[model samples]
Target: MPRDRPAPDLPEPLAPLIDAHTHLDACGATDAASVAAIVDRAEKVGVGRVVTVADDLAAARFAVDAANWDPRVYAATAIHPTRANVLDDATKAEIELLAGDPRTVAVGETGLDYYWPGKLEGCATVEEQVEGFRWHIDLAKRLRKPLMIHNREADHDLLAVLIDEGAPETVIFHCFSSDANMALACVEAGYVLSFSGTVSFRNARDLHEAAKLVPDDQLIVETDAPYLTPHPFRGAPNEPYCLPYTVRSLAHTRGQDPVELAEASTATARRVYRI
Candidate 1:
């Protein structure tokens, strides 16, 4: 069955903002020209910068290359939790080298995902996932870069491991998906919570509450592009330009002016990624 996808379009231009987490490669942008075209579209709508994250070695290599190709792009590299079993020595060595690049700003999009494979859709056992998560955590610490985490149905375990292993100084829970209590816990622990388009969904009442509690400096916004497209276009193919929709929705949820929130979120992103 062919699922109908919403046509991508420009939302109203917003104050220039940053997409803290997205995947340019997954968005059908694999070459420098294609990446630039996508980025240009984003800039026209006030999305001035983007962080393209990779979930596997192949994607990580492309992410680094894309970042090098465009000044407005930066990369985050790591093996995704579900692919934990594949994180052998050779792969880690390559990722380590990539993480050292100035264009690669973070080590992540890696964490626990109990929802996958066993619960929904994913691979690797819990043990394998934990091993990969710990390795990535260490990579971020040693590289002195922010740790970008992707948690899905394993928030408790994710937080526990970060705590047990001593989280890096800068940690970002990208596309945060948990309850308000977890949000508060992350804030209290000095971790940044990045909200994605999912926050805008009417059914995500708990997510709405969580967004409201994230402090100004600790809160950031993202499109998580090519997935989690914001409401009104929930099933659409997302691009950085679609960020305004999510930002506007987040602003409404936070009860702050949209421009104000955009500026603050952009600033927070820069501070975290150091780009």
Candidate 2:
């Protein structure tokens, strides 16, 4: 079935911000020109830079190239947990080479996604995901880069494995969707939480509460673009230019100033990604 994706429009601009995680490859960016065009749109709406994340080998390659192609772009690479079934010697070796790229800021978009294993065909089983997650964790640690994690309905296992593997110096839970307890646990353990558009949904009360509790410095913002478009714009085709919607929404949820949150989040992203 075709998605009834709308022609998404960027909202009123705010102070400049960085989209901590997004997928430029999925947002119609195929080369330097396309990447520049997408980024130009974002720059008009307060999004100064973006970290294009990869969920597979092809995306991994593109992400690195996009980072090099555009000064305002950075990259994070890893095979997504749902597709971890493809991990092998060749895959790992290439990913390592990509991770070493000065433009590649993190080793991830990887972790467990128990939500899809049974329902989705070709999804990696729990065992395979575990091995892949551990390998990515090690890669991040070795590279001295932050680990960007993608977790869905596997909070307990995700936290456990991070403990078991001796987590990298810096860890980020991208699109953090867990509740207050999980939020507190992450805060207590010194892991950063990057919120997305879902935090803007009114019914996500637990997530709202979680957002309120995160320390200002420990919280960052993302679009997870080409996905998780914010309310009033939900179901629309998302891109980095749409990030202001999520940013202002998160600031409202946390009772903070949107401009301040934007500045702080951008600083946190810069420090974490070192871009």
User: How high a TM-score does candidate 2 get?
Assistant: 0.98
Which lDDT tens digits does candidate 1 get at residues 121-199? 5598889999999999999999999999989899889989999999999999999979999999999999999999999
Deviation in angstroms for 57 in model 1? 0.5
Deviation of model 2 at 222, angstroms:
0.5
For model 2, the stretches where C-alpha displacement exceeds 4 angstroms are 1-5
What is the C-alpha local distance difference test score of each model?
0.91, 0.92
Per-residue accuracy of model 2 over 147-206 as CA lDDT, tens digit each = 999999999999999999999989999999999999999999999999999999989999
Per-model TM-score on C-alpha atoms: 0.97, 0.98
